[model samples]
Target: MKPTLKPLAEQVIVITGASSGIGLATACAAAEAGARVLLIAREDKDLRPIVAEIVASGGTADAFAADVGDAARLRAAAAHAVQRFGRIDTWINGAGVAIYAALRETPAEEHEQLFRTNYFGTVHGCLAAIPHLERGGALITIGSIAGDMPSPLMGAYAASKHAIKAYVEALRMELGEAGLPISVTLVKPSGIDTPIAQHAANHEPGEAQIPPPVYDPKLVAQAILHCATHVKREITVGGAGRAQALFAAHFPALFEVLAPKAAASFIDPARPQPRPDNLFASVRTGRIRSGEHHARRTSFYTTAAEYPGTTAVIGVGLAAGLGALIASRHRTRH
Candidate 1:
């Protein structure tokens, strides 16, 4: 069994992108763990319910509507967190957008849009909240396994997450060097049991061929709440997640050899971009509708009991991994 993550009494957590998925789960988990939560996401309608849920359940929560990538809004959010609660104990950067297309095939604006949200969002969040960080405060951001290993169909999205990993690692070092009271931890999770990929944006509307590897968002959220209480170098969710992270870190050749298969099993090329009916440029919700993906009953790769999810595919990854090893040896000899 994984080590149990403990309670955080009276501390405050500010989670960006709290309206759905992991952010939403984290907010609930943190509040359940006895911490005050300030939820930030683009939509107030979505953010409000969670706050209301917490408040209704006798947990303290406040919802703030903002684009985490916006400097002014993030700065304001930091202040709001401080005002709402005495100190900023944990700040989570969770709101992200995925723009997955072949490099040359992707539009410039689309490319910029990813970086603006995934990378800049975290930067803005950190910038705003760091000033008010307490002695044991934590700065957490979600990075993908795609960020660590090269993902073909997800180049743009992966690059943005890759940049996030770089940013947090460097920030950790710099803060440690300066002896700041703040502690920063990065989370690299695999495919989650959420609507993230389903809601992924693409050039057209349809399913695309993807890769095999996957991990659950609920599991990642569980791991995230764990990190908030216990600051460590990194906490990767799921079993294959840690292995993949290891492959990317120590064996580039192994990771390279595995990339195509990885993409095939994991990347859903058939998944279409958010060509929404509205003009507001909202992110696609894919299979999971916004305000509809409830986390109370969510779990990794599958819901608590609805249907078998990603875990059902574990055997496939093992087979692919073995195949990748054989392919690697053959290439080395050639």
Candidate 2:
């Protein structure tokens, strides 16, 4: 049986990594929509003010402090959510960390920690949320375009996302075969303007910056909320990301040849030196968007992907327009 997910106002959501970035953006948006939100993160200090702000705005929100890397602590947070809010209708595994360094340069311990938080954290969340969601609900995990297309410098981070994509897909199949009422979705976003770059453990000579054509964190939040109500298998937020994935898949040799040229853009020596990173632990939190670059406010491809019939019509229109332009040019030349 397919799961009948509840509307935003009727649902209770637990968001890990809710202190910053996509997670924080989602939490705030969910609360604004009248969902009971449980904000989980390593820092209770950062969460407290955000929760208070949400409460002050007439939203139901509570803060839970825990590292998603710790299964015991994560499970405890899940229990607390159940205790605070009768039931969980949606559980978003958004907790993740990044390392801006080559695999060779990164220490063995850093790579392990990245996997523990990014990959295993999702595993723990899925296990912990399944029991509560048996009635019917959504399990959404934040993945990345890097999951589909491996990146340099951030190889470890990309690998973790790739693992997450695989794990989430497998879990979905297992649950579907068992006929459970659960909606499992993987949200793979492109370069989102979040604090991740700032928080990354940078080993390069300069500070880290998300590559250009960054989308606002709200775009990811929008996608997450949409998946909460609608049953979707996967959603990639940016068109540029989807395009790159396609290019990499279709022409791997060429992609490999050209991809390295963009690696230098990932670092910026002009930015302030020695920025604080959160590879080992949480540094600071509470902000959503990184103001480093101008972010695109909307994604046409993402919106079109959500509505297939519309995309089809748009595709046909583009084809007809191209045909007309070509014919007109040919006639003029003749």
Candidate 3:
């Protein structure tokens, strides 16, 4: 039998990387929805303020400081959550790091670090949370459009995301074959107004800037909350992100031609280069949303992603209409 997920209010949601970015946003949203939230990250200082803010807002929240890359530490964190909340209903693996540098310029250690935190951290979280997630639990991980379409300067980061995509799919199939009551979801977001650019290990000549058409991090948080209550295979955050992924999948040669130009356009020549690298350590003190790159506040793709069935139906209808138009045009020409 298939799984039926619990509502957000009744859930004990665990969010990794909850100190900032998408994870922090997700923690606040889950807490607001009345779920008991557990925030895990490497920095204890960072988690404390966020938890205090959540509690002050009349939300139930706790903090666990641990390196997501460490399997033992994640297992301990999971145990702590179960002890505190009674059970785990949803586990979100949102802990990850990015580096802005060409593959050749990137150090071997940097590539290893990215994979350890981004890919292996997710792997550890899943392994630790799976046994404890009593029936009807959800596993959600944050991936990137870069996974589908490799970014020029973010080769290592993209490769880690690609690895995440592979394993998440494999894990989904395994769960189905076993007939478990669990929902697995992967969220691929394009550029967001996250401090990732400022935090990333920049080996490039200039400072890093988020790719064009950035959306608010709350959009991503909304998507994550949706997955907690709904069953979905995957959801891309923005329309631009979805389009880039489709283009990468269907038109590889064309993507190769345009991807570099897109990357070049993303770089701001005015900003000074070589900022402090957060590759191995945390740089920011405590912040939720990174207002680094100002862009649109809403994303149509994010709103649509919550309703997959409606999106599919609309896609099919549009395709059919186009086909009818082509047929009529050919008939008229003949």
Best by TM-score: 2
Worst 10-residue lDDT window for candidate 3 reads: 285-294
Expressed as tens digits, the lDDT of each residue in 97-211 for candidate 1 is 6755678888887788778888999999988877877455788898877777777778888899889999999998887777776768888766665555555565533543223
Off by over 4 Å in 3: 273-275, 309-334
lDDT of 3 by residue, 300-328 (tens): 67777798689889989999999999999
Q: How accurate is candidate 3 locally (lDDT)?
A: 0.87
The number of residue pairs in model 2 that clash at the backbone is 0
Clashes in model 3: which pairs?
A: 207-273
Write the candidate numbers in order of decreasing TM-score: 2, 3, 1
lDDT of 2 by residue, 120-188 (tens): 999999998999999899999999999998788889999999999999999999999999999999999
Sliding window of 10 residues with minimal summed lDDT for model 2:
271-280
Better of 2 and 3 by TM-score: 2
Better of 1 and 2 by lDDT: 2
